[model samples]
Target: MLPDQSYHIYNHANGSENIFREEENYRFFLHQYEKYLSAVVDTYAFCLMPNHFHLLVGVKEEAELARTFPKFETLEKLVSKQFSNFFSSYTQSFNKVYTRKGSLFIKNFKRKPILTECQWQDTFLYIHLNPIKHGFVKDLRNWKWSSFHGYESAKNPSKLERSYYLNYFDSWQHANYLMNIKKEAIMKEEME
Candidate 1:
């Protein structure tokens, strides 16, 4: 069931290292991302990878969210249209730069609902760790591309819902919780 009630989405990259390699490409993607984020719903966490991105979004209304996407008037179409906007925006920029043509992403963006308290916590930790997982930095604190530092320590530098995030965990404990996520445990749990 899609947008069964509004959900948190997990969207992956096309192949690998495709989206956030160059400064210009990253900027373009971020601009569209910010635009789309502004258009609908609230985001709890987001991680932009070289090839893909992940988001933890709270849906305001499943129907309204679907309506905002021009290509989709229904929840099912929302998935394709949403990614279409992202990849199409990026590809248009990329094509002009490289004089290339064709799709940038593999296909539609992936989606999943954060249906449980454990899922909410785990998904938050997972997205925050993306930079570290990919070896972009030695610590979650080092990645400037993510919302982790914004939520945990600094001001809402990314224009995200920081006040809402602040309700999720104690300020002091936020860092500890993210740092101490056991990879094996999370993999097992999320898989199941």
Candidate 2:
């Protein structure tokens, strides 16, 4: 959650239940995420699945955050609070709509800080490949819930920092390499 750092953040549902019950659920969750976290983090890539989600984000620089929040000394607290609010808002609405109760997600989410180029790339491809590994789709092209669609956009004109991450490779074809990966081996290279 620290500023100026990249993290592979992920969390699963409370148990066997699914976090995203419908297509609108995924869209609503992303809208909430962008509303609360955009100011504090630069989103790179993300994958929203049925029961869980993965996000690759880099915390904004201190100066950037300072402009968003006057009280800069408590930058960490503000950033953390934004995430807490985002989660709570989504859960509240979900419960109201589904007529359910209790926490929707597990108690604590997992965030692995990215300190190296290799880890960042690994995390990016790992996230983009999640749907395929989980049996949602045989091809990444067929999955509509992931940020991969953003990358495939005509100008990459989405909230996702697609161009920045793609810059790591030689060209867009390099990103196509994700499709070349075997399904069984992808989940094995866990982010941690």
The most accurate candidate by TM-score is 2
CA lDDT scores, all candidates in order: 0.65, 0.86
lDDT of 2 at 88: 94
Cα-based RMSD of the predictions, in order?
4.9, 3.4
The residue-by-residue lDDT of candidate 1 on 1-192, one tens digit each, is 244333456555555536566777766776887665555556777887777777777655676765666565566556445556666777788878877667666665666776676676767777887776666865667777677766666543656666555545665377456556654454455558
In lDDT terms, how accurate is model 2? 0.86
Q: Which stretches in model 2 have alpha-carbon errors above 4 Å?
A: 154-156, 182-192
Each candidate structure's TM-score, on Cα atoms with residue i matched to residue i, is 0.74, 0.91
Candidate 1: TM-score?
0.74
| Cα misplacement distance, residue 28 of candidate 2 (Å) | 0.4
In the predicted model 1, the residue pairs found to clash are 18-51
